[model samples]
Target: MRPLIGVTTYREPARWSVWDQGAALVPESYVEAVERAGATAVLLPPQADAGRLVGVLDGLLLAGGADLDPARYGADPHPRTGAPQGARDTWEFDLLAAALGAGVPVLGVCRGMQLLNVALGGDLVQHLPDGSHQDPPARFVKTEVRTVGGSRIAAILGEDTQVNCYHHQAVARLGDGLRATARSADGVVEAVETDGPGFVVGVQWHPETDLSDLRLFEALVSAGKKG
Candidate 1:
């Protein structure tokens, strides 16, 4: 059976010609990436019940979105972090927690990666500016990252590969059951994953935007199949 992959969506207010309603939405690229990987993409509505998440899909992918509320990590909001979306934060956070508890495979890209870390008690830098910033700028430019052998991330990209990143906040401290598997110049956590099997990998980059070398999605799809 094609792996049933649950892709999370961002919640936003919508308007019709003469009416308005709240809606959950995701980008077409995300859905396309999943389908291209030979998996059936299921757009999981926001604020979904956590207990019900595991049964609907073999794996989950937390797609990118707005910055997380710094409060979730016990920090004063940074000036560059933008406004908080409390409802969205609560929804994704709860879903991530339940997904991990259920042992559902996961891949968190950019903001998604941060969410995974926060859910597991990790913290994030409220905002990142270069020079004095700890990690490399999320908008990495043709840079290579190093990965440890036998590491989950290493197994996906073969050796280290150049990736496209475009986020400011990044993993400051890792979450429980996850380890930093890859890093770049200036010491940014590039990738992370669970210690064991079932493929739970998160990258501080956007692999879907890098379709030229799509090993990332293929690996997720293959793992989802196994799950």
Candidate 2:
């Protein structure tokens, strides 16, 4: 059977209408990437029943969205935390904790990475100012990251990677049990993984933004298939 990778969803609504009207919802392109990778994509909504999710999924993916609740990692919210979706933030965080506890293969992208870090007892840098990042923050520019060769990530991609980054928050103090597997020239934590097994990895870049970035998804699918 194909691996069922559960992709977490965002909880942003266009407007506060009647409760029965429902909110406009959309899944990100990463969902399609999972499909193209030969894995079944399942949208794990913020309101999903966790008791029902564990047995149904072989892997978990935490996608990018808005800022995380600083309270999650024991810090005050940054000025940019903006209109925080406390409910969605809380749900995904709990979902991630459950995934880790269940030893599910997980790939955290962008804010997903940040969430994974927090869930593992790590902290975030709230904001990245230019000239401060060991390299330029680059904001939305395409950039290169140096992976620790022979690490799981480098072994999977098999070369240096060029990715598009659109995040301001980053892994500040890494969460317990996670290790930095890749980094940008300016010292930004670009990639991370668990110290043990289960193929848990997180990248600060947006692989879903480009269809050609299939190698990562393929690797995850291949790992999930092994389970």
Candidate 3:
């Protein structure tokens, strides 16, 4: 059976056609990446009980979205920090905790990466020193990141690789049991992973944005199959 990968979605006000409403949605690229990686994609909306689904899922993919509440890591929000998506923050925190506890293969993208770090007891920089990561807004900028040897990221992306970046926040202090696996030229944390058995990786870049390379998604699918 193809592994079932549960992907998180954003809860936001959306407009389409003649109607406007709050929707639970995620970029189609994420779903496509997972499907192309040979797994079943399941979209998970924010909910109080999202964590319980980990028992049935082979893997968890936390898609990028709004900024997390800084209070999650015990800090006040910066002036430039986007308003907190409290519900999403609470739901993802629970879901991630459950996934970790269940030893499920997990991958976090962009804001998802930040969420993972905060959930694991780390804080964020709130804003980057430079605006290149998201200069024009709503667009991805290519940045080269150096990967640590022997890390899961290096295994998939080699020693140095160009990544699509679109975030203004980054990991400050690392979470417990996690190590920085990739960094940018400016020394920003680009990727992190747990040393435990099950696959648990997070990348600040949006791998799904560039389908030309699906190694990250493929790795998650392969791990899901074994899981």
Best by lDDT: 3
lDDT of 2 by residue, 4-45 (tens): 998887655455444544452545588789989999988876
For residue 28, model 1's alpha carbon misses the true position, in angstroms, by: 0.9
Error of 3 at 19 (Å): 1.7
Ranking according to TM-score, highest score first: 3, 2, 1
For residue 135, model 1's alpha carbon misses the true position, in angstroms, by 15
After superposition, the stretches of candidate 3 with alpha carbons farther than 4 Å from their true spots are: none
Error of 2 at 56 (Å): 0.8
List where candidate 2 sits over 4 angstroms from the true fold: 15-28, 130-139
- Candidate 3, residue 133: how far the Cα is off, in Å: 1.3
TM-score result, candidate 2: 0.88
How does each model score on lDDT?
Answer: 0.81, 0.81, 0.91
**Candidate 1 lDDT, 110-197, residue by residue in tens:** 8999998998889998766753322444444555778878897897786677777777778998998889999877688889888876
Error of 2 at 222 (Å): 1.6
Clashing pairs in 3: none
For candidate 3, the per-residue lDDT at 173 reads: 96
